[model samples]
Target: MAKAKNDSLFSLIKSLTQTEKRHFRLYVKRSGNTQDVKFIKLFDAMDGMKNYDDKEILKKVPSIKKIQLSNQKAHLYRQILSSLRQYHISQNIDIQLRENLDHAKVLYNKGFYKQALKMLDKTKVLARDTKHFTIALEVMEFEKQIESQYITRSIENRAEILTNEVLDTTDIIKSSHQLSNLTLNLYSLFLKKGYAKNPQEFEEVNTYFQSHLPKVNFDNLTFYEQLYYYQAHVWFNKIVQNFPNVYKHSLAWVKLFQSNPEMIIKQPVHYIKGYRNLLGSLFQLQYYSKFCEVLAEVEALSQDKKVIQNLNTEVLVFQFLYISKINKHFMEGSFDEGVEIIPELTAKLEKYQYKIDPERVLMMYYKIASLYFGSGNYRKAIFYLNQIIFYQDVKLREDIHCFARILNLIAHFEDGQDYHLEYQIKSTFQFIGKMNQQQAVQKEIINFLRITGKITPDQLRDEFIKLYNRLQPLSEDIYERRPFFYLDILSYLESKIKSIPVKLVVQEKFDGLK
Candidate 1:
C-alpha cells in the first residue's frame, strides 16, 4: 500500500505549475484530514530539495512510504497523483532555479548568479500560472549578471574565433547556441528592455573589443562573410560607447571596418550595417581625438573614386564639422597642420548637400566654438558662436545663456565692435521677456550690465531684489540663491568706478550701443 501511495504522490507533483502546486498543498493543509500528513511532508521535502547539493538534496526527499495517510482523505490523495502525471515534465526541470529558490529563506544567501540564470531560463516557462514571483525576481537578478558579461564574452569569443580559431565551449553549451546571431539580437533586446543588472558589464565588453578587435584581420574570410561578422561586431561595439571606460572602442571598431575597402565594396550589406554602428558608437563616445582620427580615415576612404557613393551624409557632415571645429582651437599657424585635410571633408559635405539636421549642426558648431575659445582663436570662436546663436533651432536654455555670456566676455577683451555679440544679447533678452521669462534672465542681465560698468552698486542690489521678488512665486524650480561670485565682482568693480562720471541704469538696454 505504501509503495503504491509513494508512486501516486510523485505522479501528482509532475502535473502542477508552481502556483497550482502551492495551492494544492494549502488545500491539503486546510482540509484537516489527518491522513494527509504524509503527502504534506513529501511535497514540503521536494520543494526544500532545491537549495541543497545533490547528496544533501537527495537526503531531503521524503520517504513517502513512511507517512500514514487517513483512508478517509483518499479522494484528495488520488487527485494529486493524477495531476502530476498529466502535467509535469521532467524535460522542463529548472535545475538552477531549484538551487537558488528551493527554500525562500535561503534564496539570497548563496548568490551564484551565473548558474542561477541557466536554471531560471528553463523554468520561466512554468511561471505562467505560478504565484512564485520571487523565483522570477531571483531570475532577473541573475539576468543582470549575464548581461554584464555578454559583451565581454562576445568580444572574447570573436577574438578567439578570429585569431586562435577556437570555439568558446560556453557558446556551444547554451541550448540556443546554434542561433548565435539571434543571441546578438537578444543583446540588443536586452538593451531595449532597460534592465542592466550590471552597468559595469557594458564597459567590460567595450574594453575587450577596443583592446582586441583591431588585432585581428578578416582577409581569410570572404567579403560577405567578413561583412556579416563585422556588422555584428560593430553593433556590439556601439553598445559599449555609452559608458565612459569603453567609449574609445567606438573609434577602434570604425578603424577596423574601414581598414579594408574590399570588405565593404564587395559586401555592401555588411559595410552599410557596419557604417550605421560606427555612427552610433562615435555619437556615444564623444571624445575629440578619436573623433578626428576616425573622421580623417572616413574622409580619406570616402574620397576614393571606387568607394560607395551614398554613404550616410549625417555622419559625413558631422565628421567634417567635428574635424573642422577641432582644428579651430589650435594656435593660428599650428592649425594649418590639420586644416590641410579639410578640403576632402568639405567636398563630402557639399556632395551630400545639407542632409544633416540644422540643430545638430549647430551643436557641433558650439562644441567647435568652445574648442576654438580654449585654443585662443577668438576669431573662430566668434564665428562659431554666431552660428550657435543665430542658426540653431530649439536652443537649449543653458547653452544659449552660456554662449551669450562667453561672447559678451570675449567682446570685452577683444576690443573690436562685436555688433553680432551685442545683437545676440538683445535677442536673448527679447526671447526671454516675450516668453514671460524676464525674471529668469534678470540675474544674468544684471551681472552683464554690472560687468560692462552700466549699473551702480546700489542699483545692482535693487535689481537683484526686484528679480528675486518676481521669481518668488516659482522658487521651486529655480535655485533662488544669489550667486556670490557675481556679487563679489559687482563689489570690486563698484569700488573702482564709484567716483567715475557714469550713469547707472537697470532697464533692458535694448539698443546695441552699451
Candidate 2:
C-alpha cells in the first residue's frame, strides 16, 4: 500500500484550500468527461482520504487497476496544477507578463507584426516596472524581431532605441543578480556561524563583504537593484554585529517597499522578508515602540486574506506573527503571557510543519523553552529543550543546536534532576565538541553544571554566587554574549542567589533598562 505521506498527488490535494478544491472540481466538470475519467475518480478518492493508501484507493475505485495507479495519480496531479494555473494566472503579475509575451509570440507567427509589437511594448513596460527583467528581455527580443521584418519609416530609429534599452536593462539585471548572490552568501554565513562573536570574526566577515560587493551607480538603480543593495548591506552589518548599520539598511529595505506599496502585492515574499529583518533589528535594539508598531502592521497584513493567498506567503505570515509574539514577551519579561499562546502556536507549527523551515520551528521551541524556564517551570522547559537536542536535522542551525544542549543542562539542573547531571554534562561537552562550538561561555556553563552535584548543599548558595560573579562579566562581554542571548544563565543564577523567581530577575533587568 502506498502511504499518503509518500504520495505527491495526495499531499497536493491535501494542501489545497476549500476554494481551490471547489475550483478544481468545477474545472473538471466543465470538461464534459468527468464521470468517465479515472483521474477524476482518483482525485475524489484521494481528496476524501485521511491517509494515502493505495489498497484503499483501489478498493474505493475498482476501475483503476493496481498497476495503473501511479500513472493515474500523476495525471491527476498535472490536471490539478493546470486548473490552479488557470485560476491564479490572472492574479499573479509574473504569469500575466508571461502570458502577454506568449500572446505576442502567437500574434507574430500569425503575421500580425504590428499587433505583436504593440503587445510587446505594453508587456515590456509592465515587466520593467515590476523588475521582471528576464521577461522584459524576451519582450525586447520579440520587438526587435517585429521591427526587422515589418519596419515602417515611422520607426526608422527604433532599432537604435531598442539596442540601447536592451543594454541598459541587461546592465541593471546583472548588477541586481550580483548583489542578490552576495546577499545570499552572507546569509548562509550567518546561518552557519551566527553574528561574529569576536573582533577577529567581525574583521573576517567585513573583509569578505567588502571584497565581494559589486560597484554600481547607486543613484540610477532600479527598485530591485536598490532593494538588493540595501539587503546586501543589511546581512553584512548583521554578520559583523553592527546593529546600528543593520537597522539603517533594514529600515531602508522596508522604506523601499513602503514607497512602492504596489510592490508589496506584486512581490510579497520580499516585502515580508524586509519586514522580518526590520522587526528583528528593532527587537535586537530593544526599540519596543517601533517594534510594536511594525508588528501591528505585520499582523494587519496577515489578516488580509488576499495578501496571504499564496501558500508560501501564508507560511511566512505564521512565522513572523508567532516569532514576533515570542519576542514581545521576551522583551517585557512576560513569559507567563508567552506561555498562553503555546498551545495554538504548537498546533500551527504541526499544521505547517512541512511548509515552514525546520530552523524557524526549532527557534520557536527554544523560545518556548525559555518561556517555561523564566516562569520557573524547569521540567517543562527541559521538555522543550529535549526536542531541540534530539532533533536529527543537523543542517538547521548550529548555534541553536549548541545552545539547546547548554540550556538543556541548565533546565535539568534547576529541576533537580541532579542524579543524571554528570552524565548530561559529559554528553553536552561531547556534543559541543562535535559541533565545533567550544566557546568560553559554553565551557563556563558546562563546567559549573558539572561541579554542582559535588558541592555540599551548605556551600551551594556560595557556589551559585561565585559562578554568578564569574559569568556576569562574560555575559556582558561582547565576544561571549551569543550564548547569553539564547539562555539568560546570569539571570537564572541571580534568581537562585536572591531566593526569588527567574521571572522577577528578568523583570528587574527590564525595569533597569527603563
Q: Which candidate number maximizes TM-score?
A: 2
lDDT of 2: 0.86
lDDT of 2 by residue, 250-335 (tens): 88998998899888888888888888898988888888888999999999989886678688999898897888999888888888
- TM-score (all chains, Cα) for each model: 0.31, 0.95
* Candidate 1 CA-lDDT value: 0.42
Reference-based TM-score, model 1: 0.31
In model 1, the Cα lDDT at residue 313 comes to 27
> Relative to the unseen true structure, what is the Cα RMSD of model 2?
2.0
Deviation in Å, model 1, residue 300 alpha carbon: 3.9
Alpha carbon deviation, residue 455, candidate 2 (Å): 1.6
Q: Report the Cα lDDT for residue 315, model 1.
A: 53
Query: What CA root-mean-square deviation does each model show from the true structure?
Result: 24.5, 2.0
Q: Candidate 1's error at 456, in angstroms?
A: 13
lDDT against the true structure, per candidate, is 0.42, 0.86
